[model samples]
Target: MFIQKKYIINPHFMYMAGQFDRNAKLCTIVTELNRTFIVDKSPLEILNDSIRCIGFDLRGAMETAKFLLGNKYMCPIMVNPIHKICVFPDKSSIHNDVKWFNPVHIARTFSSNQQAMIEFTNGLIITVPMKLYSFNHKLQTADQFRKMMLSIEQDPFSFEKDPRKGA
Candidate 1:
């Protein structure tokens, strides 16, 4: 029987609890099971931390901090510029099911479709839907994508959302 290597680590799982750095060519993924894995970035020179290049739901740092602060939670949050990823402090007691996979991969999209594909080092191909975040399937180079990701800033929320908006 030929056993195909299935992904123990999915994209959504990586998004919530992991970080990526294109310059360094690394992705640090944390599984829900509280396991940490560092992988390489290759083939996917077209994929980086660009909002326009790939589909993602991201919370800007300032916005995240405001909400977290309002909740009276004391924790350290930092952004690794080199990695272009937001790093939040992990509380040991919190358990999750996150895992790791080979980071070296290729990302491509069809000119006529709003979807993309990510091919992993293990030859596993993942189809990435691009319309969720309103990305129109525009082709973006690694540098362009990095620039966009770096340029994103969290807009300040109004009093309606944060009671202590100014305070």
Candidate 2:
């Protein structure tokens, strides 16, 4: 059984959820942020069964949408789908690609700081503050999250009994 989980992902940072299809080994992430020009969507199927990394230019989300429409790919069901494009320029030099990795190999950095890092099995690391993670039940601090994830590293099925009570 797949246990659904919810995460806040930070107030400013967009809420992103990734869905992976093991048979095809593909991942599709749908994200929603406060950026003016960005449109939030549900998981995209076009992004699946593709390469390890899929890059996107927010400025071109419209174009991407058109491409998906033309190809008969379903449009993602977004929470707040309508928004203005950001007028402020993005200066980050990072490529906007959605990379897929096995969840079993994912690990987190042990830190007391507000920010936390998740190291993927492929060695790709993404950092977000601890407050971003939302819980359906009890909350966990950054330190506690580190410990919980560490325990999972030791036994992946440890949480099978009760996912709400982290190992």
Candidate 3:
């Protein structure tokens, strides 16, 4: 049995998009098995998974539609049926991608701070943060997240203290 878990860095945290920026929002990070996977799931897939895994029990599909189409919180980074990545850009960098879909419109459509959603080649849809947390700090921050990711990428068994016992 392959155990998978998701770790969300509540976008409300300042460290998500580097330092010296103020735009407290919630960011979600999906960590599964040895890989620190990002969220690339579609809005509809995320909604359904949230309901299925998190037991959201949304009122109904209509309510779900309303929720997704009512708020401009999460910004869609890239969307193509196969994969997508969204990010909540800081106020200064918001204008960088003006040609793509209107950030405001994307946000208004989904009542979530999530900014990215991607679908893996293996049929897994994921969502990820727009800007990754920087690699600096005494406390284990996203840098550690990156390290874990690299470690897994290099030698997945290295990080596992007890592979058989499953810690």
- Among these predictions, the greatest lDDT belongs to 1
Clashes of 3: 31
Cα-based TM-score, every candidate: 0.25, 0.23, 0.19
Off by over 4 Å in 2: 1-41, 44-102, 131-167
lDDT accuracy of residue 91 in candidate 1 = 24
Which of candidates 2 and 3 reaches a greater TM-score? 2
Q: Per-residue lDDT tens digits of candidate 3, residues 34-108?
A: 343333332233334444443343235334222333433322222111112122233322332211121211221
Candidate 1 lDDT, 1-167, residue by residue in tens: 12111222233232222334546533344332223344332211112233213343223533444454454232222233344433222221122212212121223323235554544333444444444222221222222333433554332242234455654
Q: Which candidate number would show the highest TM-score if scored against the true structure?
A: 1
Residue 118 alpha-carbon offset, candidate 3, angstroms? 27
Please identify which of the two predictions, 1 or 2, would achieve the higher lDDT against the true structure: 1
Off by over 4 Å in 1: 1-79, 86-106, 111-115, 120-122, 129-145, 148-167
lDDT against true structure, model 3: 0.29
Local accuracy of candidate 2 as per-residue lDDT tens digits, 33-92 = 322122122223322211112233332543433342232222221111122111110111
* Model 1 TM-score, all chains together: 0.25
Residue 31, model 2: Cα distance from true site in angstroms: 12
